[model samples]
Target: MRFPFFSRPAPAAVQPPVADGGTLLETTGLTKSYAGADGELPVLSGIDLTVRAGEIVALLGRSGSGKSTLLRCLAGLLPPSSGTVRYRGTPLTGANPGTALVFQTFALLPWLTVRQNVELGLEARGVPPRERARAADQAIDLIGLAGFENAYPKELSGGMRQRVGFARALVVEPDVLMMDEPFSALDVLTAENLRGELMELWDSGQFPTRAVVLVTHNIEEAVLMADRIVVLGSRPYGTIRETVEVDLERPRDRDSADFDELVDRVYRIMTGRPKDGRPAARPDAERTDPDRPDQDRTERRTLATTPLPSASVDGLSGLAEMIAHRDGRCDLADLADELGLDIDDMLPQVDALDLLGFAEIHGDDLLLTGDGTAFAHADVQDSRALFAGAALDVPLVRLIANSLSGAPGAAVRAGFFRDLLAHHYTSEQIDRQLETATDWGRYAGLFGYDAGRREYRLEEPETGR
Candidate 1:
């Protein structure tokens, strides 16, 4: 599943220097926090990043990693709780006229035509109507929206609307373009096309925007588009974990060795796994599998306290099938692009397979276990039995089942489980974990949850009786 159109001849070297240019935008000890009932909830902490002129930097992190918050602070849309954001050595107190933002939702005015929408920014800057119209027209031509200038946003497709978004940003002729998941909302083909187009535009040096800051959850997008990729850790203190340089030539081959290696490197950093490919101890591995309870439990609690990966059973099965199809192995980046999934969408399923011991995440490849291959080829009943056995072996699921089975009424209050989970997870994380637990329990036929009654009851065992 590789596209030749996405590949180009490798250049001698495409890597930018450690310091590419004079910093166009710089953050010094930037921190953001909000007042909360429990205490102050910190979103970002002591973070620093720089975007130089003519560079594209991607801020990559998980859902709550404050990537968007950092983008806002950089664009002067949000005030930081502390620290300083400077533009060319000048303090940025508010929205900078030299910076423009493009949003994920295509924030175009409903009443405005494409041209009008593009002109809106210029109007706000007190540009005369004639000048605004000319700039908007030029931007429309630049983004390949020349023919649709008079069309309303509602009449445009998702990709077209986003192009309008790009045009609107470009019409302002900003020095810095801040993009918040600009291509995420589009279909796979559209996204790839837009990404390629953007690279072409940047390479041609026709656009006035001198720098770009992209906020995204997609590792492949970052690798493809960024000069430097900054990975942010989990919240409520999303700090910089590491920064990676993508030195590959443009039109990067997703299947190329170097590209895949870079993708795997980012994955390891995101999952806190070693690049040496030694397996990280999965959450239920120690307790459910019971190999080393003390160390495993400690590690489990630490990971569970963070936001749970949102993986679906279907996603897991699909990924497993892909790996099995590839002879029990598949490159993470290639598989992700083949399935039209972003890294954010793909990693969770891989993580779920790892957690259940069905697959091993070795560097950038997903290798199915014997059980995983069996599960992939198994009949319905056999598959259910296999899953049931695995689910009941998970420590949290086992704990819930034991609580219900041991109770006098053969049921336990949901609050009890919630409290138990709360001891290890934040409130938001607890909610996600609870949802995950419920789904796994249901699939395994190990427990039945009564949402209205807020209780869990033991179910008839499905296998290994």
Candidate 2:
């Protein structure tokens, strides 16, 4: 698996992979929160994780699942509100010296040449200028950026800039290499090429770092690269939902049955389907009887406890139609592939359908309810009517409708809801919640938002009710 480009002699600082297994990074009861406008907003909770030597651990989850937060915690970029993050068994007081982070955006200085950027870490460590140059040259050559060392970041392609990022991190020779969606910003082909090359380097036992931690939303990418995958859940704040071990050999075949099976298993876990065929677990306080009526279930939910997924009525309805076309049930992973979407891209829509009682996840399959099938087969106006009824079953949409009903001129300021949501969500989360609520409310003909006035007005003669 070794590539000729990475066959250069290792510098004195670039150590070979150690066979003696050791814990590189460990976190126990690590909880992170931010102070919101009204109160504290929890991001990650009770995470007990460990990254061992000679392994690549992928933290996998959709956006808002605290994948990046957990990565930052491991890198000691952000302090946890409680618990400990330890590097090689020592608790971190500040940045973990044993780790180096590569950002998704390729955070390179435009003014610095590629060699200089790669030398930055060495410079900070007070390495002699000549030694720094030598180390930087070795790293640059190892990453296939030898000729481009004199080029500034502005003159490089996205992939080249990212290579420079890798060289910069490798030059420091940190014990643990931390990457936050580093390949996500590159074009698909380029990302694949770069990812393959890096994996080759690792397989060849020449990678500078002892362990790697990667944060990603792409399931296939995680399966392709990680020795272990840690899946994070977003509901009721972030927590480690499941950890899966990849038993397949390296330079893995994506088309192999084993790989496909593993991907499906991860999908089921991510979508809250238990492997034992039982219903997925929910927070005790938020769980409701499945036999309960729609209104009763909706009544049990609140905006704070049940945040809306950022799914549009159109997008979810389209998914419903596709599922109906498959006779009301389909494998979620197959559906994602058919739609040319990553599983994470479709999760919000799946969540929306589940939230509105339009669909249910059974094992790895998405099965449309009787209501979902009908809505999918209905004509445009009829579908809208069906969707309106279903949207009303969501708490946020219900709240907005009720508020507009009780307000003067059948209108209420959007800020009123935003302020209420602030107590439970960060400003960014608040915006997303309101955005989803607004989309559902408008599609349901229950409310309309005036951007100019920031008001939600009740629709005339609401049809859903």
Candidate 3:
């Protein structure tokens, strides 16, 4: 439940025993790909995983890391291009009665009341009306929505709607419950309450599900809920980087030293830094010189393989000022609490600042450099100039800017940039990257984009002003 920095790691439980049963779901040689203009774009590759009854497995990775893809495969919502997904020794074909999926959107029908929505699955199977109604009523009560069973989805709060989602999944008596960022959309207090309630249900053996597969971006949530945490990498395909078991007892202590160390260890793994204070090999094919610190920072700054910029300059500056105001350096966990941000929201801001050399991440704390401090206090024009300089140095930005400046009227078709980026990323990824570039360009007064003309043009001195 805490996002403390992990530094010292304790030994995990070796061969932790499954409380109830044997392997409930397993995947072998799991691979998934989408059809691209050139060929197939692989998302997952050779992922071998197993889940036993009574175990909770959390798949943790960045947003575009294919965590959701893997979960979809396991739930039989989407078929993998290649590989096998077996449920209790049977090859899973499509939606199975033994499996249920809880979505982050709380995918409920607004026209249906809570009880009716909960019983939708049973109705699909043509269960007797009386039997289905009884099961739905029981499930509603189980999830603490007993009195609200007659309320329509539109009448309930976000958390209540999500609880209805849980009840719907549970009503089916599924053997495996697959959750894709189930708590991400709820308020903090509500999410924590739901997490606690779910854990209690699992502990008491009161739920229909035997095992849970959770896909999340929150390392703290993973540590708190999972028996095993699987770290995934993003590149040609999503691959398993490492698997760690949580040895701590249930009802985990957020302030425990062991918890902090484990969280730190996961962070290091995610960032490609080893716990022994050594640089680990990046999962991508392009390798960087571990000896050159500048190269590492350079790699992050470029848009080569990074996701769309999720944080704006204003957001970054606000965080920098907060860091300077707090203590020149602040613990990331404490900062998240102060800023009212989840780990998912906080990471992108941290990464943006770090990539720009304005701030640095060390263990669990963030430190602002002298330039960063000055920028935090600078006027709007000064900040834009500073950001513009940094933006021009990025490889993709530099290439685009150079190409545009060389042309007549300092203009180039938007497709020119997309074509250039497609060589390095898929079409889908290229779209996200281009959108991010546009944001950065506008912020720094580096360029102007014409959506109707489908072109990018160099900005004059007074263009934005």
- Listed per candidate, the RMSD to the true structure in angstroms reads 7.8, 4.0, 8.0
Candidate 1 lDDT over residue span 1-465, tens digit each? 111111221110122222337677899999987664345567899988888977899999887778999999998999999999987778888876568899999999999999999988777766678777877888889899989989998899999999999988877666679999999899989998999999998887786577899999888889989999999987446899889988999877878889878887898778666646565665543343322223353245333343446676666877788788899888776777677676677777877776676776656677887778887777777886777766655667777777775433477888887776654445675677778878777776677888999988775444212
Model 1 alpha-carbon miss at residue 117, Å: 1.0
Candidate 2 CA-lDDT value: 0.84
What would the TM-scores of all predictions be?
0.81, 0.91, 0.85
Mind sharing the TM-score for model 3? 0.85
In model 1, how large is the Cα lDDT of residue 131? 70
What order do you get sorting by TM-score, best first? 2, 3, 1
How high is the lDDT of residue 210 in model 3? 75
**Distance from true location, Cα of 318 in model 3, Å:** 2.3
Error of 2 at 88 (Å): 1.4
lDDT of each: 0.76, 0.84, 0.77
Please, what are the lDDT tens digits per residue for candidate 2 over residues 1-465? 122222232332344444536777899999999988766789999999999988999999878989999999888889999999987678999898888899999999899999999989888877777878888888899999989989999999999999999999887777888999999899989999999999999999888788899998888899999999999998878999999999899889999999999999999889887776455654432444433345456667888778898888789989998999888899988888777677567999998888888888878888887788888888887887887888777777888888866544588898898888888888888899889988877776777888999998876564333
Instruction: Please give the lDDT score for candidate 3.
Output: 0.77
Off by over 4 Å in 1: 1-20, 34-37, 235-237, 251-256, 275-307, 324-327, 369-399, 402-405, 408-430, 453-455, 459-465
Best by TM-score: 2
